[model samples]
Target chain A: MITIALPKGALLSDSIELFKRLGLDFTAFLDSKNRQLQITDPTNTAKGLLVRATDVPVYVEYGQAQLGIVGYDLLLEKTPDVAHLADLNFGGCRMSVAVPKTSPYQTPTELPPNGKVASKFVNCAKTYFQQLDLPVEIIPLYGSVELGPITGMSEAIVDLVSTGRTLKENGLVEVDTLFQSTARLIAHPLSYRLNLDNLNDLGEQIKNSVSKS
Target chain B: MITIALPKGALLSDSIELFKRLGLDFTAFLDSKNRQLQITDPTNTAKGLLVRATDVPVYVEYGQAQLGIVGYDLLLEKTPDVAHLADLNFGGCRMSVAVPKTSPYQTPTELPPNGKVASKFVNCAKTYFQQLDLPVEIIPLYGSVELGPITGMSEAIVDLVSTGRTLKENGLVEVDTLFQSTARLIAHPLSYRLNLDNLNDLGEQIKNSVSKS
Candidate 1:
């Protein structure tokens, strides 16, 4: 059986729809009252493991699940050893360096040296600043990163921006965008190589579903 | 005015009640519909910034918040430069090493060498394994760490255990507990040293509240 690791959150509905197009139904996760993390389709062709978005890649990398659906940002941040099969293209967002609207710095490079910047994506933020050769402290915060600048704890922050509403509501402005992220189809390397349980064929069918969408 | 950073979610109500006993109120955060991240008590003697539990110290260390409340586990993991003032004694939990109930290893050292052990507290888990002279790969996962063993991605997982309901549901058992954790009061080092805004007095009041409770 080909078990799939599906992320639990905003992108869940889109991910379920995509799999539905591939003749596998795992939409039980969309139910508000559904607490089950693991479910199997009526056809028994596939099993879905509802998990945190960040853990999707980890599950696939370790061969627990032959396939996974995850955000590109997580792929970049986690850098798991998974086969990047196709771009599912639903969860569109960008990672950017943002500062309070009233700040003097307009761009990331314009910010002062040795300043503190907070983000949940520490590695991604660190790499971006390192590429610019700007040495700054990247404080790790798992949530409400916008609070960093508003509270004066951090001069800037690097975080994922989706609707841009959160930033505007918090009185912060994007200084520079590091990358755009979207949902992608990922597979375990060994599973893909061995083509176990028709894994390769199922991968192609999912790719076709993406193209059709 | 003294700016206080209170953690959001389960700890917020208790934190606010503790502060209430100390003569400062921040219960606005407990309102279900409140979207405001920052609020001031009617007396205006203090301001409260609602933030993630992990970021509590970051705000305190930067002096954006002269005082903060966070879980002891966070203080242990982040090790921010803040004055550990008092323990509020709520939000009790423990950091533990768990494995699938079917696993043969009964102790951390008995687990397979070089096996993956996932946890959000990377530093703590690393230290625990290192002390046992057991070299294992510590995979950092921010949420739902119990899935690590269920999916066979990890032979073991080191995570926070409150009632162990999640682990029990996931067919995992606690092998060893690293330490018990509770809510703690912390302050910016400089603020504590200078006794600004009657910081020392406020600290005493909070300690008193804890003792009285």
Candidate 2:
């Protein structure tokens, strides 16, 4: 049976709706109160595994699940080995560089040499700065990176900006954008090769729904 | 007045207790329904700012709060610049390397050259592997990294192991201990330098509580 890993939070509802259009009844497994990790569909053609959104790719890449739905922010940061089947078009946002409103660093290049930048996405921030040949000390933060500049710990941050409300409330402004992010359909390379017929059908149905939307 | 950043979840109760011993009344802010960001103490000697455990350091480091209480696991993973003032000896855990029980790799050195290691603490994993000169791809996962090796996505994972129950349930075995972790008292360098007198007193009281415990 084909197995799909679905992110357990915000994306779960939309993912379930998408699968329903594919004629897959995965609603029982998608129920928020269901603590059961793995649930089989009544039709027995497929199964669903609920997991953290950031973990969807890991599950797919390892072939634990034939397919997965995850955010682009995670994909950009982790760069998992799974094949990008299609963009699901939900959970959209932008990964951007933000700085305190009072800071003089308006552009990426204007950032000082060897200055500190705090972000939960340390590797992502490092790669961004490396492209500019700028030496930076990446201070890894799990959340609330806006406080980096406010508390004088770092000069800027590279994080997901959903509505600009978080930045605005924290007295920060976007300095540069790295990428536009949206949820995408991903599959294990081996799974795609092993279950080509079934996976292809599933992919087509997802694409059809996305196009319709 | 001095300000303190306390974790909003499990640690909140303990933090309130500690502050009460310090002659500060912060119990009312512990209500989970309280939407107020900052709550003032009755005597106004200090104010409490409730935030995520992962965000505690960000608040303290940015000088938004002079001191913070956070788990050592988060501190090791984040490696923020804030001073490690005192070890609170709570929220104890160990960051360790783990792999699927079926894998033959027994030690860190046994990992195949250029193998993949997954972790939410990407920086921590990178530094650990680099110190041993191991050439492995560090896959950054947000959570549930234990599932990586189980599903064959990665060879191993570096994550916090509290009771080892989670690992055992997933058919994973501990391979190596990385670091011992506990909750800690952290201070912004500038805050410590400027408010040495008051900060030191508060630090002393907290230290006394830790020693007694």
Candidate 3:
């Protein structure tokens, strides 16, 4: 049976809906009381493994899941060895460089050369700064990137800004946008090539579903 | 006023209680409705920054906070340069190497050489295997590591076993333990030395409270 790794957060409901259109019912994962990480569709056609968004690529890369749905931002940061199948286009957000609204700096270039920047996406932050020929220290923070500026630990933060509410409420403003992000469909390279468990047909169907949606 | 960094999860309440013993009330952070990440104690004597467990050390190291409470496992993994003040002793757990109950492996050495061991504590895993002279690939997973072996992503997982309930529910069994972990009090090195804002005195008071408890 083809197993699909589904991301657990913002993209979850839509991912389940997409699969539901394909006649696979894995929505049991959406139940608040459901603690099971791995569940099989009622039709016994495919299985779903609910995992963290960042881990979707890892499972697909290891061939544990023939296909997975993840964020485009994660694809860029992790660069996992998986086939880029399609862009599902939901869960839209942008990777942005933000600074305290009260700060005089208005853009990434205006920031001090050696200033500290905090982000969960350290790799993306490093690449963005490097491409600008800017030298800044990237402090990796696992949570509360918005607090970076408030606490004075960092001059700026590179984070995903979906509604600008989080930034606005935290007294921060977007200094520069790195890139837009949305949900992406990925498949294991070998699994895709071999058409394991009729994965090609399912992939094509999902792509059609995405195009229509 | 001295600023203290408190971790957000499991250790939060205990940490708040610890500070209350120091004559500071940061219980507002315990309210479910409170979205504030940074809060000043009722008396304005000190401020608290609620951050992820791993980020606690970063805040203290950068002196954004003169003191912080975090897990010892994080201290071992990140090796942040901060003064290890005292062990608060709450939130006890241990890092252990666990494998599927059905697996033949009985210990870390019994696992295949060059096999994958998934964990969030990659450095600690690396160091443990290196000391044991076992070569294993440490796959850094950010969440739900208990699913590692179940998904066939790794031969075993090195994770913090709190109640062993998670491991049991996942059909995993602990094979070898790395070390015990508990909440630890940490302070900025320079802040502690110079008694910045009487941080030395506060540290002593906390130590006394911990000892009495």
Best by DockQ: 3
Candidate that would win on TM-score: 3
- Give the C-alpha miss distance for residue A193 in model 3, angstroms: 1.5
TM-score of chain B of 2: 0.91
Worst 10 residues of 2 chain A by lDDT: A29-38
- Screening candidate 1 with a backbone cut-off below 3 angstroms (N, C-alpha, C), the clashing residue pairs are none
lDDT for each residue of candidate 2 in B1-213, tens digit (9 for 90 to 100): 788998977678887888887788889877768756577899978888777788888778767788888888778777778989898877778899998888889898899997999898888898899998999999777777776785567999998888999989888899898899887889989878776547877888889977997
Per-residue lDDT tens digits of candidate 1, residues A1-213?
A: 999999988789999998887789997888899988889998999999998998899889888899999999999988899999999879999999999999988789987897889999999999999999999999888789888888777899999999999999999989899999999999999999999999999999988877776
Q: What are the clashing pairs of model 3?
A: none
Model 1 lDDT tens row, B1-213: 999999987688999988887677888788899999899998888999998888788889889999999999988888899999998899999999999989988788888897989899999999899999898999877688887777677899999899999889888999999999999999999989999999999899889878888
Alpha-carbon TM-score of each model against the true structure: 0.95, 0.76, 0.97
Off by over 4 Å in 2: A60-66, A72-83, A89-141, A144-182, A188-198, B101-115, B129-136
- In Å, residue B181's CA in model 1 sits off its true spot by 1.1
* Better by lDDT, candidate 3 or 2: 3
Ranking by TM-score: 3, 1, 2
Per-model fnat list: 0.75, 0.67, 0.83
Candidate 1 has a TM-score of 0.95
> Candidate 1, what DockQ?
0.71
